[model samples]
Each structure stands twice: as C-alpha cells, then as structure tokens.
Target: MATSKPQVSPELSKHYSARMVAVFRYGSLAIAGIGFIQAVIFAALGSWVVVAMELSAFVGGLAIYFLIRRGHLAFGILAGQAALMAIAITMGLILDVPTADAPRISHLYLLVLAALGYLNYQRGKSRAQLVLIGLCLLAFIVLASAPLTSPFVVLPDMARTIGTWANAVMATTLLAVCIHAMQAEFNRKDKFSRDLMTALWNDEFQLAYQPQVDLSQNTIGAEALLRWNSPKRGAVSPVEFIPQAEELGLMVAIGGWVLEQGCRTLAEWSKNPLFRHLSLSINVSASQLMHRDFEAFVRDTLVKTRANPHRLILELTESVLVTDIDLVIAKLDGLRELGITIALDDFGTGYSSLSYLRRLPIQQVKIDRSFVQDAVNSSVSASLVKNVVLMSRDLGHTVLAEGVETIEQHALLARFGCIEFQGYFYGKPMALADFEQRIEARIKRLA
Candidate 1:
C-alpha cells in the first residue's frame, strides 16, 4: 500500500530555472579566471597600471561569486553586470588604444554584457536591469564609432596585440558558453515538450483515482489525477509538466482526454452498485473552461457515455477566475444546469475576492493543502480554515479539506465543520483496477 503522506513535487517553474543556478556559479568562476589571466599577462608586459585594473576585475568577479554563494543571487547578477559595464567602458575610453593592427575591441565586450543583462532582465523583470542593458548598448555604439582622447596607461605594441587577441577570444568564449548553456536548456525543454505531445498520441498517460472521504471516514468519491509514466523518465510528476503543457497550448487537448476518460469511467460505474453513488472530480484548467466548444464538449460527452451528470464534479483553480467573469459564469452555470457540480479548487491561495464566492456557480470549495497541513499547528491557518468552512457553508457550498494526511488534521477540520475530506490520509491515488479493488474491500468490511 502507498503511504499516507503524499510527496510534494516542486512546480515546473522552479524545476525549469534550476539550471540557472549552476550556470551562474560556473560562469562567475570562469569570469574570475579570465580576469586573473589578463592581470598575469599585463604583469609580464610590465604594465603596472593595467595589471592593477585587471586585478580589480578579478576581485570584482570573486565578489560576485561569493555574493551568489551567500544566496544573494539577484544582487550578485546586478553587481557582476554593473562591474563588467564599468570595466568595458573604462577600458574602451582610456586604456585600450585603437591601434592600426588592433582597433578598439574593448567595446565589443559591452555587447556581451548587454546580452547577459537582457537574459537577467527577462528572468527578473527588473527596470534597473533593463536600464543597465540600454546603457551597455549605448556605450557599445558610442565606443565603436570613435576612440576617446584619453589613452591612459597605453599598452605597448606587443601588449596591445596580445591583449586584443586575448580579450576577443575570452569575451567571445564567455558569450558562447552562456549561449551554449541556454541553448542546451532550450533543447532539453523542447525535447520534453515533444515527448509530451508524443505521450498523448501514444497513450502514455493514465489516471490515478485518489479517494475522497467524509468526516466519518466513509469513502464518497475520488479525484481523477492525471499521471504520466514516461518510458525514458519513469514517473514524471504533473507539477513538472502541467505548466509546460499549458504554455504549449496542449492543456485543452489533454484536459479533453481527461474529461472523456472520466465520463467513460462514470459510465462503467453506473452499472456497479458499489460505486454508482460515487462522485468523480476532475480538475479543469483555464484553457479548457475558456475553450469555445467546452460546454458542447461536456454535454456531448455526458450524452455519449450516458453518465449521470450529478456524479461528475469539475474542480477549477482560482486562476481560471481571472478571465471574463460573465463568460465564465455563463459556462459554469450551463454545466450546473446539466447537474454537473462546479468546485473551486485550491481555495484561499489565489487573488479571488469573496465576492466571487457569491457570484460564481460554485457548488463546493476545496481548501488547499498548505492551509490544511498547517492548521493543526498554526493558529492563522486554523482560523482561516474555520472561516472558509463557515463562509462556504453560509454560501451553500460544500467544503472539502484536501491534503488531510493525519488523523489530527481530519479531526480538526471536522471540528471546524468541514464535512468532506480528500488526501493521503484516506488513501493515495492508485490505478483504476487497484481503486476498484479498494472499493470492494471497503464495502465487504462494512457489510
């Protein structure tokens, strides 16, 4: 039997950006090495002033590296970009003379900084970073057009030639490394996205039924969870792929498949006395609800499968509400008119106002697991859960506290007047065959 504590999987965004940490760490070290090598070359050429400037660059890179290691990643990136721009501008204007053999190549480094700045800004959306990137571009254009009068610490012909080649190679190599890492990350994601498409075509995904119970511990229903067991990647968590699916515009198609399978299961259960009364909840994404033919699709599925509409519950997250409210309400109401129940899933974790509870055609409110798990220990969580139950009841919406992984949590929720429950505490999600066997076992025990 699977354990009661369901493992929490990180969301896809977190997983997707995890590679950036490694990239930055190694990239910082590489930058520091480049600075130190340049300093050494200058020292060998007896250019004391240039050697000092190069050593400062080395120190600056190390400072950024240490800052990142200390968990100040944003600050580290900002500092690194700022320092690189300063060095490039200073060198292009003063130290790096435009010789006949080696024109001012220091300005080219600004282009690299600009690229890095853009990448950082995309991730953080910082206005300051955007401004810095603009400055880098401006500096690059200005420095490339004409060399400034000041040529302090002019390098010897030998040093300028050697430095030009060294600077070009190092800067180009740095840019190449970053691009390569980014390209590899993109390729991996692209491959995964392709795999997802192929998975749908090959039927690599299956549904797992997790039992939902009443406060009395009696099984009432199950939530149909989508599971993907990739042949190459083994068991992939929905948390790691669902967002990608949505971004790829594949969620509507995937959700349709889930609905079809769920309706078919309802049809199968209608013939079994033991499971006929059970309600099956399926999560609906924003894309699915907003689809033009969603209402017709659900209506047709119900008619084709001959499944009881009352036995189907559509769980929707708060994100879905951030759309055309009237349109959403109309679609939900249409589903409700057909005897399908609409549930607000992951309640209290979104930007939805209390006014939505009164306005939307929500038949049930599924309390998010974060609040439920902390309810027993956190006064704030307990109070929130209590109020949600009261408010849901007052609004004529059934309350289900999901992620009730312990007896204490279940008891606390019951005391708070929550009637319905779903979580690992009751039973982990299992295959359809296993779910049927579990239901039969429970029925026999009760008899």
Candidate 2:
C-alpha cells in the first residue's frame, strides 16, 4: 500500500481493482435486495416516508454499480455513498426520536463507514483520503449536535427501524465480498499448483547441464539445472514453482527425480571416455538434504542407474547448509563416505558461507555469479571475489568461478587461482545430447 504501484503487491492485492468492482457490484445487489425487503415491511406498517428512503437507497446502490461498470464516477460513487450514509445518520440524530435508537444507528453507521474507509485506504483508490476525512467530519457533526437540538425535529427518526436493517445488509455485503475475493485468489493458485503436480507425474520437468570446466586440471564437470515445461503455464521458472513444490510436500519426490536424471545422464556420458571423468552435480534443497532417506535415495539411484557415485556431486546453497550445520555435516560425510562429492553452490552471497565452509564436509565452492558478473565493474565485488578465490584455493578445495561471460573474467579468475569456470564464455546450459557433441568435438580438436 505504501508503494505507488498497487498492482505489484501480494497476489490478492494485485487484483485489488477487480476485487473492488466485485465488491461494488455485490454490495449494490445486496443493498437493493435488503431495500426491497424493508419496503415490504414498511408497507405493512403504513410507513410511506420510510419506504421512500429505503427505495432511494436501492436506486443509489444500483446507480453506483453502473457508474463503476462504465469506468466513470468510480471515485465519486464510493465517496458519495459514504457521504450519503453519513448524512442519513446525521439527520436521524437531529430528529430527537429516542435516546436508545438514534444514537445507536449513528454509531453503527460510523463503524460501517470506518470499515469502508480502511478498505479504500488499503486499495489506495483515488480520493480515498478526502473521502475518509469527509466521513469523519460527518460523524463528528452528528455526535456533536445530538445534545443541542430541539426535543422534536422531524418524523420521529423512522430511520431507527430502517437503519437496523440497512446496517445489517451493508455489513453482510462487505463480509461476503471479502470472502469471495479470497476464495477467488485461492482457486487461481490451486489451479497452477495442480498443474505442477500433474506435470511432475507426467515427466514434464527436464534437466539442462552447464559445464564447470576446471581449467587447471584440464577436466570437465557440470551442474544440473531443472527446467519445467508446464502444459498450462508454459516454461514456468524454478523461482516460481520450486517453492510451491516444496510447500506442497513434493520436493522430496522432485528432488529424487532430479538425482536420478542427473545420474542417468552421467551413465550415458560414461560410455564416451572423454566425458567419463566429469563430475555430474545436481542441486539439493534443504528439505531434500535433511530428508530421512536422502542418503539411501542417492545410493539406490546410483545403483539402479549404474551411474558411478564417485563422479556424482550434490550441490547445496550456503543458506541451506546453515539451517543446521551438524545435520548438514553428517549428511555430507555420509554421502562422501559413499564416494559422492558435496559442493557449496552460490558461495559468498550468504551471511555465513565462509564461517561454515571449514566446518562442512564440502569438496568444492562455487563463487556466486553475482560476484563474478559485477566484479569487472565493481571494486567491492572484485575484492570480495579475489579474497574468496584465494581463501578457497588455500583451503585445498576446488574453486569454481561461475558466470564468467567474457574472456577477461575467465582470464582474471584463472589468475586469481580459481581452477574451474562455468558461464557463457565456455558454454551455456545445454541438453545432454548437445553437450556430448560439444565434448566430442573439443576432444577431437585437441587430439
């Protein structure tokens, strides 16, 4: 709400305008329906003036609906309706009907106006502040004049009878509109979540391999990245759907799938002697790493796929490892004892990547692309990266500099003692087949 762009808010707030229109339309229908019911009650009691007022409310609500639908008078309609309600309550107070009824009606109207004002403020619609001020002033005037007015003012405040009904109708309308908006939002998210679930089952997610070339060792390795091709959503990013998968209790299953796919790719590559020594790395989420059967999953997948566990690498971000250092260390040790390697992905971006680097059983550290991409242009980034590369190499760990998109970055990192590199300078992530062809060609050229 503080930001100028309301459309950029939460999922529900992004649809605030549409929700407001719905509220107006639904509120209008509610007002008309309640007004008609009031009219019938007054007709039985022979109260013509009260009937007229109720009928007026119904017409006003109808007019507001049309105004909003036409994209005209949106601001005026919301402000005018609140103003009119306040005026009606003020009139009721002036007419000294009964201490019990007039004041209660006035207070009820004030509360309803406040509710509308708060919603308007959150929505940040046009003229909401002015409208709130006007409503507040109206309430003050009604309360202030309640004592000074003459004993008999007008038609004995017939609104007391009608006010109760109108208040109830408006309250119910507001409540229903909010509930409807929330339900609509959930339904929208549920659709995508369902698509993701179905996609997981239908084999819609695939892996892309980015080579992590260890220049000093003259060896090739790769990091496996997940890509989702949803039939409904079309190329949904991991940023958008992976968290949803995690929240839906599907990460363990999805993570297992990734592990198997990466190992299967490794198995295929093993046929080509040039690619046999390459480390095939796949990312592991915190949830997956902490999973009770994660180690077993890795062992079983490697056995079934006939993929060499010695050549398999499991990558975890710095923050993921810091969740519980002991658990991470134990897990990494167990996997390493099986001849599998553990990598610290996106290092230097986390608060304590360095602090825990020595503590964890990590074999390699990948300097985050953010540091490399900006290092050429930013002195601070370059300094941080230099320290990281130097410190990591000194620790006897395989240091990889990722996102080395230029000859200069690759040359600079190699000079900085970073033995490994991955980025556009070498090659982007590619399908297993494409990468195999590239490896074969590079090997042939060198021979």
Name the candidate that leads on lDDT. 1
lDDT by residue for model 2 over 1-447, one digit each (tens)? 000111121223323445565665666666667657766776676767657766766676677666655555345446546754754564455532345554444344344445454555544444655566476656646664555443543443554556555655665556565556656646756886798889889999988877778764344788788888877778766655676777688889998888888888889878877788888878888888888999988889988999988898888876675577787788889999999988888787675555687788888888888889888888898888899987877777888887788877877777777878888778777787887788788878789
Over 4 Å off in model 2, which ranges? 1-181, 216-219
**Where is model 2 poorest over a 10-residue stretch in terms of lDDT?**
1-10
Most accurate candidate by TM-score: 1
- Per-model TM-score, in order, reads 0.77, 0.62
Pairs that collide, model 2: none
Per-residue lDDT, model 2, residue 45, is 68
Q: How accurate is candidate 2 locally (lDDT)?
A: 0.69
Given candidate 2, what's the lDDT at residue 126?
Answer: 49
**Per-residue lDDT for 1-447 in model 1, tens only?**
011224443221233355776777677787788889988988888988888778877887898788767767777878888997898888788888687677888777788777776656645567888988999999998988875656456678988888888888888987887787767767878998999999999999899999999867888999999998999889887866786787799998899899999999999999999889889999999899999999999999999989899999999989987899999999999999999999998899896778999999999999989899999999999999999999999999999998988999999999999999998889889998899899899889989
Q: Stretches of candidate 1 above 4 Å error?
A: 1-25, 28-169
Backbone steric clashes in candidate 2, count: 0
